[model samples]
Target: MINGILFRQRTGLPWRDLPACSGSWKTVHDRHRRWSADGTWERILRAVQADADTEGRIDWSMVSVDSTTCRAHQHAAGASTRAPKIPGRRRSPARHRSDEALGRSRTRPDHVGGDKAYSSRRNRRHLRRRHIKHTLPEPRDQRANRQRRGSQGGRPTGFDKTIYRRRNEVERTINRFKNFRAVATRFDKRA
Candidate 1:
């Protein structure tokens, strides 16, 4: 049943339009929803990730964390104002927009490279916990905050300028992922 759902997600098929050959689509969809609600999906994903780590599929020596905005149709927009847009057109008639769609995790080849948007304390802490080398530029707000606090603010975290150049690959990867119609359209109703 779970496999059917995975297939639907990979193929970007409407839930109601799932093929009969895959078995009862309703059963699969229901199971998927139930698992999501119960946090079973998260646990499964974590387990697989852990297993991959143990088997060496994951390179903890370097990992990247970045977010991409998957633009949605005006009809798909939610109640958020900062959502992705259609671009080029001047007017936007959508009532609500969300900037975030789905998040995908990837293993960085050597070191994680990101911009100021990823400079949050929590993100830095996560990288530290994973023991992954990273370079994330500081945001203007954080810099000002540190300056205002003087010695109390402590020194800003060191960021590698050379490694940060590699951050361009993150954007390239996002572009490649978006090449898939399913990813671009966000046909999967489930997160």
Candidate 2:
């Protein structure tokens, strides 16, 4: 099952078109659905991350964060909706987000770099709480809001041009990852 999913990720195959090398496509789909519902994928991703950290592959001295929208196929929309909604629930998850696994840890980076999308107060506070210096430019709206509040608006957060230069590392990483046709092509229906 694992090999099938990894193959899909590598080969950009439609889930229904998963090769029979491992098992029936139905079995792979069933397993993927069950794992998605049970947070198994989250656990697996975190485990891989932890292993990388343990192997000294993670450098908390510098890190960056950004989000990208993956265009979804129209056919993908109905899968979650067809599932029975919980009592009193209003809507299906646009994208499921699961909890961090036990033992998951985020080290304090010497410097953090991100774009305007990450320039929210809550994100800044979280980084500050960890004592991680950040170089994200304040958005124009946030600046205006702060100025409007006068003394009540805390001082503008610090920004460092030099540190921000390292933000390209994350962009490059994304480009490299997307160089794989499967990743770039959005073969998986889900985010």
94-187 per-residue lDDT for model 1 (tens digits): 1111112122244333466667777887987887787666788888889899989999987787877666765665567666665655555654
What is the TM-score of candidate 2? 0.69
> Model 2's lDDT to the true fold?
0.69
Clashing pairs in 2: none
**What Cα-based lDDT does every candidate model obtain?**
0.62, 0.69
- Supply candidate 1's per-residue lDDT for 88: 23
Clash count in backbone of candidate 2: 0
Whole-structure CA lDDT of model 1: 0.62
Best by lDDT: 2
**Error at 112, model 1, angstroms:** 4.9
Model 1 scores a TM of: 0.56
